[model samples]
Target chain A: MRSVRYTPPLWRQWNLVWNFAQRDLKSKFKGSALGWAWSLIVPLATLGIYTVVFSFIFRAEPPDLGNGRDGVFVLFLFAGLTAWTFLASSINGGISGLIGTGALLKKIYFPPYAPVLGAVVAVGVQSLIELGLFLSVLLVLGNVGWSWLLVPVWAAVFTTFTVSLAVIFAVLNVTMRDLAHLVTIALQLLFYATPIIYPLTLVPEHWHSVPLRVLIEWTPFSQFIQVFRGLTYGLDAGSWMSWLTMVAWAALALGIAALVVRRRGGDLGEEL
Target chain B: MSEPAIRVEDLSKVFRLHTERRSSLKEIVVRGRSRRAGSFQALEGVSFEVPRGTTVGLIGHNGSGKSTLLKILAGVYRPTSGGVVVDGRVSALLELGAGFHGELTGRENIYLNGSILGMSRREIESSIQEIIAFAGIGEFIDSPVKVYSSGMYVRLGFAIAVTLDPEILIVDEIIAVGDEEFQRKCFDHLFRLRNQGTTIVLVTHSMGLAAELCDTAVWLDHGHVRAIGPAPEVISEYLGAVNENEALSNDEPGMIRAGLDAVRSGSGEVQVRAVEALDQLGRPLPVVLTNEPLTLRVHFDVKVPVRDVTIGIGFIHENGTGIGGSNTREHGVPIQLEPGVGYIDYTTDRLDLMPANWRMSTAVRSHGHVYDMLEKAFPLPVRSSGGSTEGGAVRIHGRWGAAVQEDSPSTAPSAATP
Candidate 1:
């Protein structure tokens, strides 16, 4: 006699996603004594190691900032690390998102994409915290300029790219559990393949160097990192072609991932 | 009449059983052929309808497809065949606190669980205090759920579930959690919900609770509907079949019972030859009417000579709750047995048992050791003249009369008259 076909509104579903994202953020460092400070330890140590190795051991000169000032290698590395972590952590968390929320999905019914989106949000927040620290250092060094206004725009572009990849991996991982592990290894390889630890110039300077140069310049990960460094370093910025490449990649990833989710989301509980 | 709240056609579910774990790509590439694993029919052609505003119960043993059916109704698992049409929103408490995180505080978990159940944040905020009050764990709602005891965990989960007030509620054995008082409180809430026109489907092993609460009952045995009808009638039929199964399993060599071959178990030293149920006038009967005096006559024979013999008689409810028993040892009636045929008769003044099926256990022992025992010897059906009062297994006969009280202050001064 009563209708059972009511669908919840999109805003309500988004609120639910927000609640889960909050849980993911709070529970990550729930028991650690140092709390969220623990997250800074690894990146800071990596920055220190890279600065030492490149500046002292390799005797490499730091790059120049926009106003003809020499950029500190650690600051440059920290900028690249923040963008890379945002991209990598979001993908990693998204790949394992459904499996991580297996207990919840098995019992209750909700929008299937909430867990994947929530995981991305958690990592995104953490990346933002790291970005805050990075920006403070840039201000103290007086290296910031008008180009810094594009930081949020860069973050938006990177989030769109990262979340789409995460959703694709997460849905695929449900059917092929090895995909989660395969993705970890693949992302690790992509990290080095893209120019995170080194500048793009590390690749051969020849114009006819098609394969390596294409991977370094045309891939979405490389484009995202280039834009991030452009906003922070305020020089050596990529052309509008790089921004166009990143947006197109994000749209492509989202379209493919959305199709996969529609095909497989309902049956994910059985797979789990 | 209103349309049925749940209409289920020939619903069935099949589960694929993988013979080997082919989760890896290399193994599939190397050794996979058709990839056809075996299949198990967890449910087969289960068809039933639950009318609006009525409580229907599913009663069955373990692995009898009760949980699978409930999951299907709750839309957790898709049916392999047929279909179910539900007219209202369905909520299930399949496993308590399944979505709760151990590290989250109870306050946070409440919102999370509410959102998971499809409630808006505003609705949860409005009903948060009521949920806490129902859970009754003062000051513990602020602590992380990991620190709560098992009882407290289920209490909070149940509290949240019932407060949501879905149109159709399907619960699978969740009431077995928590203490007796909490169980009673949960049942009371369910009863209140039923009164408000909520259609409820309960899957439980407690036949008495089914008989008490449900308007209809479906008995599932081995993924098939064994019987479906009125609650008490179907439960009686199920209990009778269960008793027959126990009788077959308890049958040993050289021990026999009469009137009804129900249950018998023990060595055959002194075999229990037969057991008969009789009315007050001593006429042998297969069934006895409630409130009529009934007698159980146990006939025995001595396969080997036994010295100190004691005879005992007991009544067991169909659900295996022991009612009462009497033994010759407790009565101090010692008998010297040499061998030969003998019978012991245990009579009751009034069979106050409610109208239901029951089992009678008879035994012949020496001192405290059993020489021969007959378990569930007779399948006794106590028929009531009318419907029962629904108190419990037994009915108590007591007089009830009331008189108007005189409003006189001096009446309290007279102890004898008062």
Candidate 2:
């Protein structure tokens, strides 16, 4: 009999993870006539609608680029939306990961996190592609800067952070199905609460003596968007405090995710 | 020598049956605390060891925990309170195509499924050709599996599982699917694996298959181990208990009426009581040896006087294919019946049947009108003295001879004259 380990190390299961991720990516556009072009088209369409609503309708002022040129409001919104879309889709996919692959889990023995991580990686790849297209648009607009080198570094950190959150929510969603619904509502609220659509300058320093600016600045989504806009839109590496905050958030979420998985993952097969 | 391949100690699994299944927060809040639902133990203190290089079969009725035990062994389910130590790598075929995606092509699925089974990418790449050849689905390997027939799906699943060459293989009634030829191929592959000393654990309803393949059999009944011993002995004990339960059920008034109306239909004159296979010395034989004289005796209770009665018997293969049959009228034998109980014997000089499981079907008719008919009323197990190399339902008896022939019409007469 083959010995089974309930939680195999991620490095050992890399191939399996890659296979799952590939399957997910392929099936996303499998039979469609547009194929992978749809990956680009869907986000472009979303960016177009958001730009029209916030830039033209709301008359939001655009931030200045590091090249000392007037930043296009569409470019400013695209930078923030890229990071926001990655976070939203990764968490959503993670929430459904275990429930969707319940049939496979009941038949075979592998680490429960493989599918969850695979889903995160699949979305991560799409987000990277979207980032690439956004950078190309910056290149065409002559808004490039040296700080853009840190974009890959920030993306890696953001992915690790996303993975940790995905794992925690995936494991939790297995026991309480209402978690998914709650998460969907929470994400919709968080989108507006963060600086994805509106400029951070619009809000006062304090609302009812609450110090609302500091509160919004520390929200993980806001911190991520701040660093993303600094790299591609503002063309600066942002502040060390923001970088430290991103790393700390990733580390904290990872610790909680590990604890959640260790406690609840063993009996997942029975629950399924 | 070395330790057994698998050692399961006092394994138990209890499933909590949630009556209301309050997975929503609204229900939890409205109902206060989530009430503890009733729990049913699927497997209780089940202990067994499968020796290295030997096969063990789990046999039981549905919901008897055979499947639960297999899953626990496969590591798909963890035992509640017991420890299961497996010595080597394990591959379980709990369900064919368990991880298959409908949108993926057959080749893509193999890569994904193989990796899920713990094969490295290189290992799957190395054996991809062999798996495709074994499935025999031709160019359909490139087509998405959703479009393939169910047989093709099962074939590909079985192919990938068997080719993995794990130290211990776990299977659950997977061979029951597919055509006969494919089933034979699967058996041949399993036989080879057993010969190569791969420890195997199988769950199957076919006692004949269990007897043929397993070294030992474990019989489970209602979360308890009823018997564990040599394959044949344990199977016979299980079958005996099943027959007893059936007889007990038949005694119920409702079941008796239903049985008379469904399984038995005839005129209200003669009613068949029982069917038995007996040895030449007139003793009830549960298993008959090949080429031995045997008799099928049919007992009947005559409710009214009858004449020109014909008692017939038919041998049906376990697959429901009819082997052959005969009636007293076909042999020019006539019988007169009156009230009271009696039995008619259909005796044969030699039973020329290969080693396989068969069923006996009997009927009584008079004046071309049915009297009592019982289809597949009794099981007949034929065992060869030793393993036979032949296939199919019946054994053919003939002599092998050779004759040298010359290239001349007159001289080749001996070769042509059989």
- Highest-lDDT candidate: 2
Clashing pairs in 2: A1-B88, A2-B88, A2-B89, A2-B90
Candidate 2 lDDT over B15-67, as tens digits, reads 88888787766677788656667888999999998899999999999999999
- Interface RMSDs of the predictions, in order, are 2.7, 2.0
Per-residue lDDT of B344 in model 2? 84
> Which lDDT values do the candidates have, in the order given?
0.78, 0.84
Candidate 1's docking class is: acceptable
For candidate 2, lDDT tens digit of each residue in A1-272? 44455446679899888888878888888999999999899999999998888888888898788789986888888999889999999899877767888998888878888998888888888988998898998899898888989988998889889999888988888877888898999999999899888778876899999998888889998999988998889988899999999999998999999999889887788777
The whole-model C-alpha lDDT of candidate 2 against the native structure comes to 0.84
lDDT of 1 by residue, A1-272 (tens): 43222347656587677777877877888888988887788778878898898878976655677667876777777888888887778777776667878877666666567888888888888787889898898887788787788777777777877887888888877777777788789889988888777778767755575567766777778888878888787554568898788889888988987898778776666677
Best by DockQ: 2
lDDT of 1 by residue, B1-418 (tens): 8789999889899988888767665666688743657888989999998998899999888899998888787766777898888888888778777778788899899988887787788989999999999888999999989999999998899888877878898887665577788888888888899899899999977776787889999999989999998998988787767655544664341133444545556666787776676777786654466777877777878777777788888778877777878888888888777668888777887887776677777788775677777777666666653334365788766787876456666654555584
Q: Judged by TM-score, which candidate is best? A: 2
DockQ of all candidates, in order?
0.45, 0.62
Candidate 2: give the TM-score of chain A.
0.96
